[model samples]
Target: MSERGGPPQQPIIVRRVHRRGHGHHGGAWKVAYADFVTAMMAFFLVMWLIGVGTREQRAAISEYFRNPSLVPGNATLAPPGRMGPGGASDSAIKLGGAMDLPHGPGKDTRGAAAASVDGRTVEKEARRQEQARLQELMQQLRAAIQNSQALAPFKDQLLLDITPEGLRIQIVDKLNRPMFDLGSAQLKPYTADILRELAGFINRVPNRISISGHTDDAPYSSGNRYGNWELSADRANAARRALLDGGLQDAKIARVVGLAASVPFDKAHPGDPINRRISIIVMTRQAEAAALSQELADEDAAPPAATAGPAAASPAALPAASAAAAAAAPGVLVH
Candidate 1:
């Protein structure tokens, strides 16, 4: 029972409907997931940096991002809290890690680095202060010498220099104004006065002192039969006594050496007027004493070969005599 058109008739409808992705909601979600992953990776990198970087390095980095000009060199940068030209974020500055801060007593790396810097600064300051004090002391000594009327005559004969050993004052002898009378160990009145003034300065400083006596190469004709070595020693001892009498503490004087003609001022010209002088050396550091001691030990430990020439000759002569006896005895043995 099929009617002409009704038997096979189908309904027809026209409409448009948008369907979601079968596998995914939308590509927008994919973009969000990618952003999230990138943020997590950046966070992990920041954590790693924070863990390994020193306090100073971290602060430098933070300060660099905050104000690139503040870095050692004037490097250009983008604004703070923003990505740089290469898409590098300045988020490290905002993180405020342990190294980002200025180190206090026990804050972070900042503290430790600051402590080291401060310690170095203090040491430098101490050295500068010490140098200034030494310069001031030298100036005072110069002024004292200049002001002393007694030292006026010896001013031209005096030579002063600053060495690693300390202050060295040399008193050269003048032909007419000798520091002492001929063949006498006593200091002249004027020389004594000069020493007194020098002694005052020496007593103020906390350094060891040495007084050395030198003599001209001229042979002793004083009729006392004393040579330059004895004369030089007497003179050194006399000077040491004068210094002690003039307010220098006995303990402060480290040594008194009579160099005689051994250490001349002018080796090429032994008769040079400057060769006959006394030297007062002040020791600034203990190393100077140690060096001097080593030098003395080396001198005392001279090789035996250098000193054995006479002894060796004597033994050689004995050997020759023994050979002559042996040759003379050969004929006697036959008899």
Candidate 2:
């Protein structure tokens, strides 16, 4: 109510109140935050510079940090004498923009190149050793043919080849003269003789033997259960038996498989008689070692057999089998 109702008194104003503390005391925290940001930026800048330096430059920088007072390259006087290490700038340090990363263990370029060279050298040496071994084996076979007269009668039928597996001795079939019966695994008399003859000579070497039987693409005539695959396997086994009869050690046999028309001798003529044949592979030491990796651990590879006599081999490699094979399979039978 206005005094004595003269006028409507205005409501007493109470809109203002005092604040407790003036705004944020001063900006001390801002100065501290600015300093922290600046320090971080400087740190990252130094890291970037170090990251972009060359190997030698980085080394020099690291050395400088280790001993900042020491100067390089006889840089004794810089300002007073006006002398420097062959440059207008008194600094001996080279700040070339070499962005080479620091090398750690196993990261050296020279070491890697040397390792590659060593690998190539090893491969070449292995190749040379394999060739020497094959040549020695060939010489042994030639001497056997000349001296023993075992293969003289059927020399024309023999075919020799060098394959990645090793030396392959292919005994192919002729038109009228077949190694096995027309459609059976039964060996002809001549076939058995040839296998036996080959066995005796092959036995002299320390190498193991592999026999594979192949057949023509023609299907078998009879037997619902038996087929060409079975026949081929049986034929290979039969050959193995003949080899055993010819005094080849039982342990000399490595593998016997049947490949019925899979790897045909005459690809153009799948049904050719020559396709029906037996292959005797004298597996190289490398191949033999690879086989051992799948089956069992083998002995360390011996150096190639000594090149002494045509039929040179360890007398200890006699065909007693049980003990002799164990002794001979590891080392080359050097006479």
lDDT of 2 at 220: 82
User: Residue-wise lDDT of candidate 1 within 54-113, one digit each (tens)?
Assistant: 665566566545533221222224444333323444345633222232333433343455
Query: The CA-based lDDT of model 2 is what?
Result: 0.68
lDDT of 2 by residue, 148-238 (tens): 6657666656778777667778888988889988878889998898888888678756778778787898988664656676777788889
Q: How do the predictions measure up, each by TM-score?
A: 0.51, 0.51
Stretches off by above 4 angstroms in model 1 are: 1-131, 221-225, 295-335
The candidate maximizing TM-score is 2
Candidate 1 has what TM-score? Answer: 0.51
* Prediction-by-prediction clash tally: 2, 0
Candidate 2 local Cα displacement, residue 60, angstroms: 27
Q: Which RMSD does model 1 reach against the true structure? A: 21.9
Q: Give the number of the best model, judged by lDDT.
A: 2
Residue 155 CA error for candidate 2 (Å)? Answer: 1.6
